[model samples]
Target: MTIFIQSFGYQLWNIITNGPEIPTKLVDGQRILNMNNEFTDHEYKLLQLNAKAKHFIFSNVDRIMVTYEGTNQVKDTKINRLVHDYELFTMLENENISSMYAHFNDIINALKGLGKVVTPRFR
Candidate 1:
């Protein structure tokens, strides 16, 4: 009985020492949100852009055109990648979120620089 108790105690100690693995996505999100001014700024911008992306993806929007703001529309093909990335980002709840957020922000920024309103559609 003493031997069995010692083994059980060791097992319990091991369990206490090694906790369950946390998903990387949660860690990345926490890291970005917890960082300094630059990331804070990105977080703010991301919130707005995320909202726009969500609406664009869910709504009846078709394509983005830069005619009024600039010259050419965001090509349909490129938009597919953006949409795909956004959808995957939204659907997944892991470490991919941080990377996806960065990529999505990049695309949004590029579109905005061209004077396009990112409804995910700019005409």
Candidate 2:
């Protein structure tokens, strides 16, 4: 599992550096927003890719925490460490929930590309 997670991390880094296109959908209501600063095509693409990568990383970390094993071999201390890492990542990456939702679409696409076999636990 550690090896698999490392591989996923590497793939995610690649997706971040190389611009990946994520399809967008229109949401109901809300005001129409505009970008105040102009961006080149390449810069726009990079922004999209980074958004997607960040989204996937956040969601996956959450899922991993939800289903983390705390058995004999996997001690409670280990689980706590993993959860702490996830919380730290979330705090460092996301400023607010609104911005997180804004990038949801791109994150979904990135997850889809990663095979979409996440194990999420229900509370």
- Scored by TM-score, the top model is 2
> Which lDDT tens digits does candidate 1 get at residues 1-123?
234223545433333344322212246446323334434554555445544444543352333232323323445546665555544544245648678677678767655554544454334
TM-score of each: 0.24, 0.29
Off by over 4 Å in 1: 1-95, 120-123
Residue 66 lDDT in model 1? 26
TM-score of model 1 vs. true structure: 0.24
Residues 5-27 of candidate 2 have per-residue lDDT tens digits of 44666555676556554434335
Which ten-residue region of model 1 has the weakest summed lDDT? 60-69
